[model samples]
Structures are given as C-alpha cells and as structure tokens.
Target: MARILIVDDAKFMRVTLSNILQKGDHEIVGEAENGTQAIQLFEELSPDLVTMDITMPEMNGLDALKAIKNKAPQAKIIMCSAMGQQKMVVEAIEAGAKDFIVKPFEESRVLEAINRVLG
Candidate 1:
C-alpha cells in the first residue's frame, strides 16, 4: 500500500477520495485543502503519492504540483479535475504528474493510475 497525500478544497471531495483509497488499502498520510498546505504536508509526510485537485483556493494544483516536484523531483502525483479541465490536466502531465483522474472519480481508474505510477 502506498502512502498518499490528498489535496482538495472541498471536504466532500477529500472524504470521497479517502474512502476510495482506504478501500484500496492505501495509507492516507495527510489531507490538505489548498496548495500551500499540500506543499507543507508533502515535505513533512513524504508520501509515496499525491492525488491533487486542479482548482483550489490559495494556490492551484498545477502550481502546487510544480512546487512539490521542485522539492522532490521523483514525487509521484496524479492530477484530479472536473470534466472541463483537460487543458490543465495536460499542463500537469507536462509538469511531471504521473497521471490524472477526473472528479467524481472512478474506482478502477483511480487504482489503475496508482498502480501505474507505483509500478
């Protein structure tokens, strides 16, 4: 099981993803509501992976992803967005995210991305 950090402004989204990850048997090292918190948690927790929401208050996921990658080049991140955020997803991939999952996440897809990134 991977140690994962979840970052999303919405509490519901964070809970949903947490349930899914728990079902998959991954450990949730931390949860953050925005980019700033995410970066700080990442530095402290050093989780194996992160599921990052694209749009958030304070700082956006893309910026946070860049920040985390700068801190740890090998950090594994999966961008999460709603249906219309493909442009940002692409930018995330370019910025070095291992993969992405759309909001209202699918169980199989989320696990798949995790496995692929871990593999």
Candidate 2:
C-alpha cells in the first residue's frame, strides 16, 4: 500500500477518506486543511500519493497541484470534487492531477481510483 496525504477543507471529508484508505492498509502520512498546508506537508512528508479537493480555502487544489508538480514532477495527485465541475476537472488535469474522483464518494469507486493511481 502507498502512503497517502488527504487534503480537503472539510473535516468530514478528511475523516471519511482517512477511514476508507486506512482499511486498504495505506499509511496516511499527514493531512492538510488547505492548499498551502497541503504543499507544505507534501514537501515535508513526500507521501507516495495525495488526494486533493478541488475547492479549498486559502489556495485551490488546482494551483496546489501545479505547485506540487512543479516541486516534484513525479508526485501523484488525485482530485476529489463534486459533480458538474467538468471545467475544473479539465483544468486540474492540465495542472497535473493524475485523476479525479467525484464527491459524495462511493467506497468502491474511491478504492478503485486509488488503486488505479497507485498501480
């Protein structure tokens, strides 16, 4: 299992994702409540992967993804967002996010996405 970083503004989202990934035997290196924190944590922890939310306070996920990719081009990031944000999803992909996971998350889908990214 890969070490993962969960970056999202919502506490419930972080908790939910953490619980789900933990069950897969993944180590959660750390969590970030905002994009800035996410970048900092990434630099420090250098987790194998990161699950970043698109709409976050302080700095958005797309920008943070760019920053992370800039600093670590090999970094793997998956964007998690709600439905109907096609434009943002495209932008996130352009910014170097490996994949996107629609929100109101399903456990199976989330796991599948994680496996795809980690695989």
Candidate 3:
C-alpha cells in the first residue's frame, strides 16, 4: 500500500479521504489544509502520493501542484476538485498531477486513480 498525504481545507473531506484510503490499506503519512502546509509536509513526510483539494484558503491546488512538482519532479500528485473546476483540473494535469478525483468522491474512482498513479 502507498503512503499518502491528504490536503484539503475542509476537515470532513480530509477525514473522508483518509477513511477511504485506510480501508484500501494505504497508510496516511500526513494531512495539510493548504498548499503551504502541503509543501512542508511533503518535504518532511515524503509520502508516496498526495491528494490535493483544488480550492483552498492560502494556496490553491493547481499552484501547489506546480510547486510540489518544482520541488520533486517525480512527485505523484492527484488533484481533487468540485464540478466546475475543469479548467483548473486540466491545468493541474498539464502541470504534472498524476490524476484527479472529482469532489463528493466515489470510493471506486478514488482507488482507481490512486492505483493507476501508483501502479
């Protein structure tokens, strides 16, 4: 199982993702509320993967995705977004995000994206 970092401003979202990941037998290495924390935690935790929310307080997911990629080109990041964030999602993918999961997550899709990215 992969070691993952969950990044989201909403506590419930983080918890939900954490639960799903735990049930999938992946270990949660860290959780960050925004891009700044995500970057720091990424350095400290070096998790195998990161699930990053698109809209956040301090920094958005697309920016964080780019930042993390700058730090570690091989970093595996997956952007999480709500319904109308297609443009940002496309930008994130171009910036080096391995994949993305739409908000109000589906367990199967979440697992599928992670499996494909980590495969």
Candidate 4:
C-alpha cells in the first residue's frame, strides 16, 4: 500500500479523502491544511504519494507541487480540484502532477488515480 499525504484546507475534505484512501488500503502518513503545511509534512514524512488540493490558503497547490517536485523530482502528486478548475488542472499536469481528481471525489476515481500514479 502506498503511504499517502492528503492536503486540503477543509477538514471535511481531508477526512473524506482519508476514509476513501484507508478503505483502499493505502496508509495515511499525514494531513495538511494548506500548502505550507503540506510542503513541511512532505519533507518530514516523505509519503509515497500526495493528494493536493488546488485552491488553498497560505499557498496554493500548484506552487506547493512545484516546490515538492523541485525538492524530490520523482514525487508522485495528484491534484485535487473542484469542478470548473479545468485551467488549473491542466497547469497542474504540466507542472508534473501524476493525475487529478475533481472535488466531490468519487471513491473509484480517487483509487484509480492513485493506482495509476503508483504504478
């Protein structure tokens, strides 16, 4: 199972993602409320994968994604975006996100993205 870090400003979103991932048998290494915390936890935990929310306070996911990728070129990051953020999603992919899941996440899609990225 992949060790995963979930980053989002909403506690509900984080918990929801955690539940879905746990059900998929992936370990939740850590959770972060914003990009800054995400970056800090990323370095500290070195999780196998990260699910990063596109819009967040403190810093945004794209910036954090870039930072993480810069530090660890092989980092596996999956961008989490709400509907209507297609532009950001494209940017995320170009920035090295392995995959992306739109908000109001479905369990199947989340697991699919994780599996594809981990593979």
lDDT of 3 by residue, 1-119 (tens): 99999999999999999999999999999999999999999999999999999999998888888999998999999999999999999999999998999989999999999999999
Best by lDDT: 4
Q: Which stretches of candidate 2 lie over 4 Å from their true place?
A: none
What TM-score quantifies how close candidate 4 is to the native fold? Answer: 0.99
lDDT of candidate 2 over 24-99, digit per residue (tens): 8898999999999999999999999999999999999999999999999999999999999889999999888999
**Measured by TM-score, how close is model 2 to the native structure?**
0.97
2 versus 3: better lDDT goes to: 3
**lDDT measured at residue 30 in model 1 versus the true structure, 0 to 100:** 96
Candidate 3's TM-score: 0.98
lDDT of each: 0.95, 0.94, 0.95, 0.97
**Per-residue lDDT for 36 in model 3?**
92
lDDT of 4 at 110: 93
| Model 4, span 1-119: residue lDDT tens | 99999999999999999999999999999999999999999999999999999999999999999999999999999999999999999999999999999889999999998999999
Compute the lDDT of residue 23 as modeled in candidate 2. Answer: 89
Q: Which 10 consecutive positions of candidate 3 have the poorest summed lDDT?
A: 58-67
What are the runs in model 3 whose C-alpha is more than 4 Å off? none
Error of 2 at 97 (Å): 0.8
For candidate 1, lDDT tens digit of each residue in 10-107? 99999999999999999999999999999999999999999999999999999999999998999999999999989999999999998999979898
Q: In order, how many clashes per candidate?
A: 0, 0, 0, 0
| Model 4 stretches astray by more than 4 angstroms | none
lDDT of 4 at 111: 95
Q: For model 4, where is the 10-residue window of minimal lDDT?
A: 110-119
RMSD of each: 0.6, 0.7, 0.5, 0.5
